[model samples]
Target: MKIAILVEGATERAFKKKLCEFLQSHLGQKMPRLHFITQDGPIPKERKLKKLVETLLDNNGYHAVIALTDVYTGKPDFKDANDAKEKMRIWVDNNPNFYPHTASHDFEAWLLPYWTTIQKLAKHNLSAPSGSGSPETVNHQKPPSYWIKEIFRTGKRGKDYNKVIDGMAILKNNDLMIAINACPELKAFVYRIISLCEEDKIIS
Candidate 1:
């Protein structure tokens, strides 16, 4: 049950250790090898994406290829999560083995679930975003990454959010299920992986 996840860049790749830890607890021996491939940017556009998926399936030994992109990428490639996924599905032409997932605004949206941990790691006491503290609601305008980066910047540490490092720190030892419950996109991502691995759906 090997799977490949195509993402934007190194920030998501930093998820490797924590993500695996979470998967192992639930899937146990059924946990699959998840390969995360980066685009050095957002998942390739349209035909290029189709081409990449085809290559992974036909040339590489992967069983399935999943693409996760941020709806709030610097450019307005996608309006929102649904729009982003819909576009990818259309672009991929609904290939059965190809799955498209998104972080509502960006990768940092996923990190928002661990605010307490973030404050601890960052040595900051910034409050969570006002609206419901729901990660997904952190909009594209301000975006979760901006809030996180701001917190790190103004905090006692006086540093910026290093997407590559801080993201993994926030996720470490935290329960993935918490974020899954908070973010629908994350739930969908986990659902696809769990379903492919043939495990009982603990997420529901």
Candidate 2:
């Protein structure tokens, strides 16, 4: 089956290759073809979002369309993961073929789990983000993106964090499962995709 996933800009589109490889580890030969469509930012809201989903679903060639958005999008788009999903569900009229997923706060939270790798790549000794210590728990007051950018800015070598470049380099050698296990929103995101592919649901 062919699936269309609406994602948050260049970083996610670039990360699609790693996602498919991770899914293939479980779904194997049954992995569905995934197309990551970048929105250049967060996915649209309300009627615009509904129209986007409907248009993708309207194509018989696609079995489903999933939307992936971040909770803390710099502007108050969603209160949290559940709020985002519920609102999207309402906007899409609870269509079975349309699924919505979120990166709590933002995608950079996933990268936080690999802080050891980040430190090496950044050439900085800056400690991991302070909080409850859980990546997802890194609240929106500052958010993961803020921490990431801060590290890159002050680090001896990092200088800057390109969402598409440094983000990938940080996660490139790491397993997606690490982030999924550490972040509830990430788990739900992977769960939706794997379950739709008829693969084992990740329980962590």
C-alpha local distance difference test of each model = 0.86, 0.84
What is candidate 1's TM-score against the reference? 0.94
TM-score list, all predictions? 0.94, 0.94
Tell me model 1's lDDT, rounded to 2 decimals. Answer: 0.86
Model 1: per-residue Cα lDDT at residue 29: 85
- Kindly list the per-residue Cα lDDT of model 2 for residues 1-204, writing each as its tens digit: 789999988777667778888888888887899988889877998899888888888854688999989888889878888899999999989989999888878888888999988888888889888862579889989889888888888989946888888887988899888888888887877888888878555543
Which consecutive 10 residues in model 2 have the weakest lDDT in total?
195-204
| Per-residue lDDT over 1-204 for candidate 1, one digit per residue giving the tens place of the 0 to 100 score | 889999999889888777888778778889999998988987898999999998999899899999999888899798788898889888978999999999888888888888899888778898988752678888877988888888898888877889888887888788888888898888888888888897565644
Q: CA RMSD for every model?
A: 1.4, 1.7
User: Which segments of model 2 are wrong by more than 4 Å?
Assistant: 199-204
Residue 123's lDDT in candidate 1 = 89
Off by over 4 Å in 1: none
